[model samples]
Target: MSDLAALYSEIEQKTSTFCTTYSIACAQGCGTCCEHFMPDITASEARLVGAYLLFIKKDFSLIEKVRQSIGNQEGPCPLYRFDSPFHCSVYPARPLICRLFGACAYQGKNGFAVFRRCKYNEEKTMPEHIDFHSEVPVMQDYSYLLRSLDDQEGEVGFLPEKVASMLDQLQFLAVMLDMDDTNPDDTPNPMAS
Candidate 1:
């Protein structure tokens, strides 16, 4: 879990720098992306989100929302909160794809990094397109970083299904492993092999 935390931190820093350097930004208070997008996430990502929901946010209703959303491959992410200012209920624990959605570049067929405005960027705050000749934070690079931290060889499922499944498994372990007395920070990482 510490590995993931470190990886996430590195990703945040890199993406922030990349976006800033490119003058790319998302529209303020607009969550149209999460509104219709469902991310595919690795098991390690699911475990982090599940643990955050259960132990940190203590939001069982959100957990129930995720449970109810299983097999939904077209709808909005279960963690999206329409009424919240932050929008994503599990923002800090969101998966790698979520973090990289509008912030990073992708390896292009021309062997360079490319970034384009998100489809949801109707406000068009970001640049329409940018090609990077120098090295940039390419999505594939971060994909590998996330996979290296994943215990399951980076098997991915839609966010709702993965997080729901993780919640069920983590719950079973919590009870059997008697984790009630442990602080959230002290709890054993379910994502660890």
Candidate 2:
């Protein structure tokens, strides 16, 4: 696996550990966060997700739908399958923001880190003496890692440029593998009700 892929795996492990330790439970089938927010991601992170799509041979039409949805300010995440059952289609390759969305720590006004519990995880209680600074993966640290790897300007929103770049990268990989670009009109949209 590439360095970026390894880092992503590490991130997944850490976040999973954090959530498990904290008993943070996101409400199943409730995609309020995914519907309301588009995650910020770095170029390297984008590349990883793109690579995964290519590896899975995801339909170009579905990818195009996601690309189009990326620009929709009011729409849910393109990767989120909202119709049959709301879930991330690319959950394994989701960005850091998505992985750590509900279970993270933020620096407080006093420059100390504190646990930022998800509003949806009402049943979980944060421990008083938990070490937020060391336990939780800091966003800045991951951002720095991605910047070092890709050296591209990080994107802060679900912008077209970022999605386009990811698509281009995924297409490039597909081309390298000599994969046929079949007509994707028959591919069903996951967001369609």
**Which number leads on TM-score?**
1
Query: Which candidate gets the maximum lDDT versus the true structure?
Result: 1
Query: Cα RMSD to native, each candidate?
Result: 5.2, 6.7
- When summed lDDT is taken over every stretch of 10 residues in candidate 1, the lowest stretch is 181-190
lDDT of 1 by residue, 1-193 (tens): 8888898899899999988888889889988889888998889888999999887888777788898888889878888889976898988998898889999999999888999899999989999999888988999998887887788787888988888888878776775576663223355555553
lDDT score of residue 102 within candidate 2: 67
Model 1: residues with Cα > 4 Å off, grouped in runs: 177-193
What is the C-alpha local distance difference test score of candidate 1? 0.85
Please provide the root mean square deviation of candidate 2 (C-alpha atoms, Å). 6.7
Cα lDDT listed for each candidate:
0.85, 0.63
